[model samples]
Target: MRTDSPRLSRPATFVRAFAIACALFFLFPRHAHSQIHPTVSFEVASIRPVAGGESGGEGGTRSQIETTADGLTMRNIDLSEMIEWAYKLQHYQLSGPNSLAGSRYDLRAKSGDHVAESTLRLMLQDLLATRFKLQLHREQKKTSVYELVIAKGGPRLPKDKSATIPPSYPKETFPRVVDGGFVFQNVSLGDFAQQLTEIRTIDLPVIDRTGIPGVYDITLKSAASALLDPSGPSILTLIQEQLGLKLVSAQDLIEVVVVDRFEPPSAN
Candidate 1:
């Protein structure tokens, strides 16, 4: 008589579910699985408050965080801005304590190795969790926002005539501060939307509604005064006039990052 082999005990419900997901991921087409999220953490990190609480030249996304082979430095950046970089969300998309909104910090994080900008964001998230006790959730909320769309005439910016389809983005990326504002070359529509969102021109994060796809060259500039004047040409106007893209007003379900709690960092 053959003895029956002992049956393997089933794992907990959550574990079973996870195992099933993994099985499906491997058994099915690769595209069926979600893209792997890059995670990079700092080997040694320090977070300090900006003494003056004032954002100077080093402020804004353009100069927010710089990652080198050895480490990364974030200067004069508020928690709000930091979250924006970590999650790639707009400041308007985040909500938390009033103080946290304006509280800026100088962060020095090192990993001893160079990583992609996308990976750097992951490291920033880890740093926030370890230091700031940051926590957040995502929800879709109905909000009135501008959708970037091609105007009746089409885009004012010219397509890169010499741009030939390449396997990837250009190796020689142009400097962002070409003419004082922001310039992009060999950029895709998705990348352009992301750049526009970081500019803080529109009150709400812009949603790209343009049906256009592919890479192109873009130059955008707006006088601070122009954006401040309600009657003057705003970023929306600039996009329409210069880029031939319009930000149409519409209500859509937008992803909003909800901050549950954020405690101040511990001692350095």
Candidate 2:
């Protein structure tokens, strides 16, 4: 049997082993074996557009004035008309802890887009940390409440998919002073001031602006430039323009006093 059988050589066995190894390499390469893959991710949220600020809008209050000389007098007066001009001052500084907080952003791949969201976010985060001294945090509080979800529940968008976006206002129309008031058009600052002064100084048959002197309402009622910080402008005008804040009549209320006892007239 030994003389009849043909035996396999070491070189042949070596060659066979090499061929098997090559076949395995072709079927499952190093990359596949290690589970390497290109994955898509998403950001937690998106940046919304800026909006908000003042709108020099409408509405006012009414006051009754009884003329000493005449029996009765009735007139509808615009409060803003009483003022000549107004000035405002404000203070803004990035000093608080949250003011310099850091944010995290995840990266995502668009169907047709090449750039990744994560890449952009990382770059922005770095810039904020190094240049702006932004702080990074991760206890849920630092993150935005909203979530960034995909449109079609996939990494890529469909052929003609659309996304619904929300509106944003950087500065919102807020009432600087909580009062009912309106804006007077076509009036110069100096002229208005002079008129106000005249009404106060002359005291010529004007409404009694005593005790609670009539507070005037004035507003800028428009968007402000970046250069326009809080304090330089007149408080009156600045309030209108910056906050849409108007002057409203203060609520009339009487206070009650609790006295233990009223001692009658002491010994005369």
RMSD of 1: 8.9
- Over 4 Å off in model 2, which ranges? 1-6, 36-268
lDDT of 1 by residue, 35-150 (tens): 56544588898887776754343544332555566666777777877887788775557777777656667778787776677777888888888788898989888988767889
Q: Where does candidate 1 stray beyond 4 Å?
A: 1-40, 53-63, 158-203, 211-223, 227-235
Model 1 — TM-score against the truth? 0.63
lDDT of 2 by residue, 1-268 (tens): 3566677799998999999999999998778834564332222212211113111121212211112121111122211110100011010111233211122111111222334333333433333233334342221112111111222323221121112211210111122222223232222232223222232222221112222211233333331321144445443344334433322233222221111222111221
Ten-residue region with minimum lDDT total, candidate 1: 166-175
Clashes of each: 1, 32
Error of 1 at 123 (Å): 2.0
lDDT of 1: 0.69
